[model samples]
Structures are given as structure tokens and as C-alpha cells.
Target: ELKVEQNPLFLSMQEGKNYTIYCNYSTTSDRLYWYRQDPGKSLESLFVLLSNGAVKQEGRLMASLDTKARLSTLHITAAVHDLSATYFCAVDINNTDKLIFGTGTRLQVFP
Candidate 1:
């Protein structure tokens, strides 16, 4: 099986709302990362989780990694039209740079 899974392949959220996306992995990994991509643009780094219980946040987005459970979460707060984008989580197996990415979560922030 592939290494990663993300829930809610698509999400439509209203402005001023909150949501959380979950990412689950099948194997042990050394690092987990979250990225966001605007329409027609490359992904921009959101968070990099290096160890168990590592958590990071920026603006309205927060990400956490639990190595022991092989899980990661990206929480979105106060949705806005500007936040409409696709989110992806990736895992670096055994500390290698080659990351296996989740299918992705497409979020639409309704105005």
C-alpha cells in the first residue's frame, strides 16, 4: 500500500469557519511536511514536522506530527476566500528526501 492517506479529498468551507484535515501513514518515517498550493501555482511550504509531538502553525493554519502513531494533522482556522487552495502532506521515509505525498485536500473558502 502507498504510504499516506488524507481525508476529505475535497472540502468546501464557509468564511470564518474552521476545519481539520487528517493524514495517516502506513510506515515509520523520519519527517512529515505540509504544503499549500494556490491555483496554478507550485506548492508553498506550510510545516515540517521532525519529531513526535512536533507542532507548527502559521497564520490560520496549524500542523502537527505524531511519529508514534504515524499520523499528522492540519488544522485550518477562520476560513477565507484567500485560503482557497489545495493542501498536501508528505512523508520522508527513513530521513530520505524523497517524499511520498498524500492524494491532497482541496479546500474552497466560500465568500
Candidate 2:
């Protein structure tokens, strides 16, 4: 069975501060993906870490995956209130496209 765990289920930071969200899985996975969802809104794709040591960055957010350790991280740099949202990490088990998502990390940034 595949299980996913995320740390700091909720995060509150001041604008321009930095923080990181972690995701760990119990088994091997073919790919790791990240998503963001605003309150009561649909999810939006963020990054897809396809290999070990893979990293992707966009704007103020960056995501990396370490397959050997079954861990993925989403880092926020110079956070802003606009970036506030719920972030999730998902895994494609055995490349099956069946994604198991973490509980989610709700981030709130204040000025």
C-alpha cells in the first residue's frame, strides 16, 4: 500500500519570508507532482518532478523530488499573500497514473 504524509499541515508566514513544505511517501513512485488550490477553487498544477534530484521552479515557488528517499519538497521564497493557498504533493504509483495525494499544507502569507 502507498501512503503519503505531509508536514506542517498549516503554515502562516509574513510576506517576504521563506518556508518549505515536505512530502514523504511509503513506497516507490514513478513521478511526483505538486498542485495548488485556493479556498473553494479548483486545483492548479504546479510542478512535476519526474526523476530523483529533479527540481522545478516558477516565480516564488520551487519543488524538488528525491526518489531514493521517497521525499519531495516545495520551497517558497519571498512569499506573498497572493501565494496563499493549499499545496499538495502527489505520487504516481508504479507509473500507473493513480495518484495518491498528501493531506495538504495550507499556507497563509500576510504582509
The number of the candidate with the highest TM-score is 2
Across 5-96, the per-residue lDDT of candidate 2 in tens digits comes to: 99889999999999999999999885999999998999999998899999999999999999999999999999999999999999999888
The deviation in Å at residue 51 for candidate 2 is 0.4
lDDT by residue (tens digit), candidate 1, 1-111: 557999989999999999999999999985999999998999999899999999998999999998888999999899889988999999998776889999999999898
Candidate 2: Cα lDDT at 84: 92
lDDT on C-alpha atoms for all candidate structures: 0.92, 0.94
- Per-candidate clashes, comma-separated: 0, 0
TM-scores for all predictions:
0.95, 0.98
lDDT of 2 at 25: 98
Model 1: how far residue 71 lies from native, Å: 0.7
The candidate 1 region of ten consecutive residues with least summed lDDT is 1-10
What are the root-mean-square deviations of the candidates from the true structure over C-alphas? 1.0, 0.6
